[model samples]
Target chain A: MSTHTEDTKDIWLDECFAAARQDTTAAPDDLITKILADAGTMQQEFATQSLVATPVRAGLFARVSQALGGWPSITGLATASLAGVWIGMSAPAGLEGVTQALVGAEAVIDVVDQYYQAEFELAGDL
Target chain B: MASIEELSDDALLVMYANGDRDAARVLTLRLTPRVFNHALRLLGDRAEAEDVAQEAMLRLWRIAPDWQQDQAKVTTWLYRVVANLCTDRLRKARPVALDAVEEPVDEASGPVEKMQDRIRAQALQRALSDLPERQRQVVVLRNIEGLSNPEIAEIMEISVEAVESLNARGRRRLAASLSDKREELGYVDAH
Candidate 1:
């Protein structure tokens, strides 16, 4: 066949496909109802499984943890507490020195004031 | 909460998995026609098609909880399921009698045009039934269903090149088969 005839044949085939594309066969109402009924039964089974699987009353900590956004928040709180404990247990030497320096400054001020008062009294006595 | 209508098929399936009855209804309404039509075309039997469609949807419902999002399109998955079911049925039983398949009525066209279209469609269906199983599937998916070669490849579990080759062969076979009916189908003189 010539190319033109081949093109015509292809066009005709496409037209046949287009006609077939307008098919009206659908899932009947009875089939839909049956499928939906199956789904409903499955859903009920899932519901029953969920009801049976879940505890009726959660523990206090479990409830609190859930209220606080579940495992993530609990994990964060635990991490912060551990960090605080580490800081307290492993206090850096610099921090201890700073605390000691603050206490030493107060003692130094008291001693200087006492020395100054004694000097004033001696001058008065002279 | 978005209504089931606003959800994609995957989302609707997820909702159905969570026991939302409306999601199941929406998915059924959305998917059943495509499934039914595909099965009917493959098997050429309405009752068998109905069984296939129902079985396919039931499988969907059962697998909803395990459906991996983004892995595959819902329609593609369903098409594969229906195709496999039809193939099994075809293997187990004799071929469907073409005369038993009814032509669909199109109310949009005039009576004569509607009759012509129905006759053409029926002829095509009969011709399609004569094709090898894979060729029939590739042709139906590419032509009547308007799926791309790549999509058909995914559904048929083949490469795109393979899909193209199958489609080409199927079309050639279809053209050869339908050549005798061209004048009767009113396409010979139209050119």
Candidate 2:
């Protein structure tokens, strides 16, 4: 084709394309509603499946928690653990010598020494 | 905590799959119009286009859970779905005789320029509907939809070369079919 003819065709086609691009028809309201409903229904199915699947996977933890008298008892146990750690770290004035009286300072130190010695020997073996 | 509007389609789809109702709403609003427009351009019938658009969106909702973001973009996947849906409909549909299509109703009451554009658009749509399915799809995606050649290739499941070839053929056909109507479409001197 001649250059002028080609350019003319190109320009005409470009105009056609531009017009078509602007000729969009909005999606019908009914269609949008139907699509949204489908989305809602799919989401609901997933939500239901997840809900049903959750406790099954959590069975072990649920059973253990229930056997220990539920969340309140777990909270108490956790609090007691923290208290024990605190007491061990800093004993009250009157209870300062209680560990020495119960286990004896020398015996406690010997037990600690044995533990370190065992760990050291194990490390050496490795 | 970005609003749903600010989230990408992939992110919104992931959220929708995870039971975010707002995500579902946003996706429905954001994608349905595009899906409908593309289907309309391909099918050239509003009702059939609506059906295709709805079916495509339904598939999107179903696939959101398994959507692999690293593999393809959501819009790319959607264009593929819409293209496939329209192709299926066209295959099942009776072939339309292009010359039998009636001229669009006179819309001359509007401004002159606007009327001219409407006439051009109507003429183009008629010409498009007469094309072979693949050529019509490639042309609409590349020209009307303003998608990149690579994106059209992906959507049509063809090579870029194939897309370019189909586009060239489609445009040539369109130009030939529309040649007689050029003056009527207000291209008096190509200005």
Candidate 3:
């Protein structure tokens, strides 16, 4: 290994530390001209994208699906949640008072239980 | 000084932010060649270097509006962009195998110019390849592209003191690794 000069801060080191850096291996100058010629390409792409990007009416299944995390998963979760909610809400009048209290507790339990269904074990599972 | 063309970097950038195509072209023209050189030296691949340079400039053009005059200097911002792009590429790439494939040139002929340029290029590559990534970066920024310590520090996102320290260590290591070929490298006479 070569011995180095001391970490001597100097005037010339400021100027001369790097090698002579004028690019001797020059590429043809037309490369720059061509790059300049292509300058409008990005703007044109942006314009085209804008032209095609207006929102359209969503399909029923897609709208349902997109309600969750695209469409299908969202639709299923919403259907399940609404079904459970309707079952709780449409119970008999006599049971309404009891059901209201039960429903409140059930809603809490349902939310907690469903929140981690993928993590928790199911009834028949080993 | 009088012409719109002679406006400062920040002034040109402000004009660019207002959608002045001329300002964009001027900035691109001013910065591209050096950015290309920096990226080329870092990646040791011409096409990749060009891509990185273009990407860096693209980012620059995008962010010109919000650029802080003091906190963000044009070339310094570009240096960081090029460095980050090269870093990303390096992460996905193994060390390149540089075949001795010379692009044919039609310029005035000399056996000495060809030999020396070839040797210099190869030697520079080997020397650079020998460096650690950070050290190589410091060397390239400080030496080849000829940015100052503060500017390099800003680009590298480090303190001025850190820049000094890194440059010192990098130069020391490089000088040691390259000492044997000191004469060949035109650093010092072997005799």
Superposed by TM-score, candidate 2 places the C-alpha of residue A50 at a distance from the truth, in angstroms, of 2.2
Q: Total clashes, candidate 3?
A: 3
Candidate 2, B75: how far from true, in Å? 1.0
Docking class of 1: acceptable
Query: What lDDT would candidate 2 get against the real structure?
Result: 0.84
Q: Rate the local accuracy (lDDT) of all candidates.
A: 0.85, 0.84, 0.66
Question: Which regions of candidate 3 are displaced past 4 Å?
Answer: A1-20, A24-126, B98-118, B186-188
Q: Write the per-residue lDDT of candidate 3 for residues B1-191, one digit (tens) a residue.
A: 36766877788887776656787677667777878777777777777777787777777766665678887777778889899899899889877765632332326566675555545555665666567777778877877676787888888888988878887887777556656765675445333
Model 2, TM vs. native: 0.72
Model 3 residue A11 CA deviation (Å) reads 14
Local accuracy of candidate 2 as per-residue lDDT tens digits, B35-60: 98888888887788889988999999
List clashing residue pairs in candidate 3.
A2-B176, A65-A71, A66-A71
Model 1, position B171: C-alpha lDDT score? 90
Candidate 1 C-alpha lDDT tens digits along A1-126? 011122234878888888888756656799889989988988887788788988788899889999999998999999999999998999988888887777874555354588789999999999
Model 1 spans > 4 angstroms off: A1-9, A53-126, B1-3, B105-111
Report how far off residue B51 is in candidate 2 (Å): 0.6
lDDT, ranked from best to worst: 1, 2, 3
